[model samples]
Target: MTPPRVLAVAGSDSCAGAGLQADLKTLASLGCYGMTAVTAVTAQNTRGVSRVMPVPPDMVRAQMEAVLEDIGADAVKIGMLGSPENAEAVGEILGTLKGVPVVLDPVMAAQSGDGLNAEETPRALLAHVMPRVTVMTPNIPEAEKLTGLVVASLDGMEAAARRLVAMGCSNVLLKGGHFGGHDCPDLLFEGETGQLTRFAAPRIETRNDHGTGCTLASALAAYLARGLSLCEAARQAKTYTSGALQGAVSQQLGSGHGPLAHFHSGLL
Candidate 1:
């Protein structure tokens, strides 16, 4: 029997913490068949990112087309595009394919505070990638970068989310992970229905929250690949991520912001 397929277009993490590694782990844990089009290769560990060598834009396009044209994807999760060209190329490819679930993570930095995208990459993504994004999950800083707004409070997050939806994303999940709060308030805004839902999970006190952004977005894509609605997918994805963070409390992985145990179910 053929399983639902989720294609992850992202960079490769040498620590196997985030990027392609996190994406694949999340997809598999959620019971979806996973495929990939690696955009960049990073030489680093859980502590911080040291070097990032991007795959050529043409090669990135080739990898995407090869998997998409043949194996086909039920959903796609786009993480860090190494450059403006890479972002535009991916956007161009997805624009041609209609009715596929695409979750754009809009990654900007590593958990240990290393830059991911170039200065112009966000603008390029806004121009090219936003229109194709079914659901965009951006943390506070990313939202601020994308919208040019000061995202410091829940009200600010809501306003930023509305702005993101107006930019062409079908839905926006504004993650509140950058700040310290008892409840991590995530706001979801639906473009079609204008319905908003809030997912507030208690902040798991652990530095092992690395790769969570990638993990959450990939989980959303996986659930969508399995034929779940956007709301349900978001719901499940949040639960999955929360569980990983909770499990990380007991984990002994890396020195700095360690990776979450995506396979917590199996680990237990």
Candidate 2:
């Protein structure tokens, strides 16, 4: 039998350390079949991003439609669109597939402090894409940018999550890893039911967290494809990322910002 299908609409990472590579790795580890509709192509590595070339809006549309129309998707994970026009294109397509669970990672910057999107990308996501998201995963900085709140603490994180929920997004997972601490806590604010939950994991001290946001969102989507609840998916994804980081703490992957150990099954 074919496995649960998880489609990743994101960018391509040349180093196989982030973007759709991370998504695919997480998906397979979670027993989900992965597909992709690349929105941008990044000249990046464990070090940092050198250049970005966004796929045209029309091409992005074609890629998404091609997968969605054929194999379809049990869940969708969206990452860096890189441009406002591509964001709108995806928004329209996902709007039509409302029943499919969509995990949105508003990737604004790389872990290496490289800027990832155009200035207008976030606005387009907020207006066109966010409302359709089943789970919105944003790091502290992303939450602040998307919600216009000063998220310097956990209380600020809660406030920012609520703000994003109020902005028409379905659920918000405000990630706290960016906040300076050894302990990381992610707050989940569900919009329709007003349910709130927190998933916390101690920070793994390693620069090898390049695609964490992308990995978390993709892992959540993969778990959702397996019929897990939103909270359960988030919790499992958090646990998975924590383990991946812990496993990579000693391994020398790269010079600058490396990648998490996505495969615990020892497959690759």
Candidate 3:
């Protein structure tokens, strides 16, 4: 059988720990053929992002068109858009996909606490991207920024998920890793059915957590492309991500936050 095809619209990470690199790794590891439309190029390592050059919106669109118009995509994963214009560009593409599932990872900051998007980027995502997203994945800080709600607890995550659904997203995946507990839980709210599902996994203590959000979002897209239901896709993605995190526990990489072992399912 042909491999699932997934397009990753994100930035490029120099260190390969996050952004397009991580997205590609996750998608490939999950048996998906990955393509990319880089929104920005960042000089970043596990320590931090030093500089970022936003790709022109027209060029970003051109890249997406070149791949999507030719090969097409079974699913799409959108991450750090860098600029509001680029966000709109991605939204325009979403309008044409029809039924293809889109996993949007609202990547606002790096694991090293460096801001990745512009001030206007969030507004653009809310206005242009949210309504088209099949599964919108936002970490605690991102959910707070998008919903203006304190997402410090499980209840807060529930409220924030509802707010995101109200804001036009088809579904919301509120990632609770930033809540800092013994168990990290993610809440998925399906807008159509009003069903909320909670996925829990023990938090692995490791500095190699960089790119986790990108990895999870990409894995979700891969699973969706492979014909899994939303809930099942989320479950499998979480399991894959947990294993990746666990596999990286002994890895000694950069001085700061490193990356997850994306190929943990097989290679050791």
Q: Judged by TM-score, which candidate is best? A: 3
Q: Candidate 1 on 1-268: residue-level lDDT in tens?
A: 9988999999999999899999999888887889999999999898999999888999999999999999999999999998999999999999888899899999999998899877789999999999988999999999998899999898998999999987777889899877786888888889899888988888899989889999999989988898988888888899999999998897888788899989988621
Q: How far is candidate 3 from the true structure (C-alpha RMSD, Å)?
A: 1.2
Per-residue C-alpha lDDT of model 3 across residues 60-109, encoded as one tens digit per residue: 99999999989999999999999999999989988888889999999999
What TM-score do all the candidates reach, one by one? 0.97, 0.97, 0.98
Predicted structure 3: lDDT: 0.93
Q: Give the alpha-carbon lDDT of every model.
A: 0.90, 0.90, 0.93
Q: How many clashing pairs per prediction, in order? A: 0, 0, 0
Off by over 4 Å in 3: none
Best by lDDT: 3
| Model 1 spans with C-alpha error above 4 angstroms | none
RMSD of 1: 1.4
Candidates in descending lDDT order: 3, 1, 2
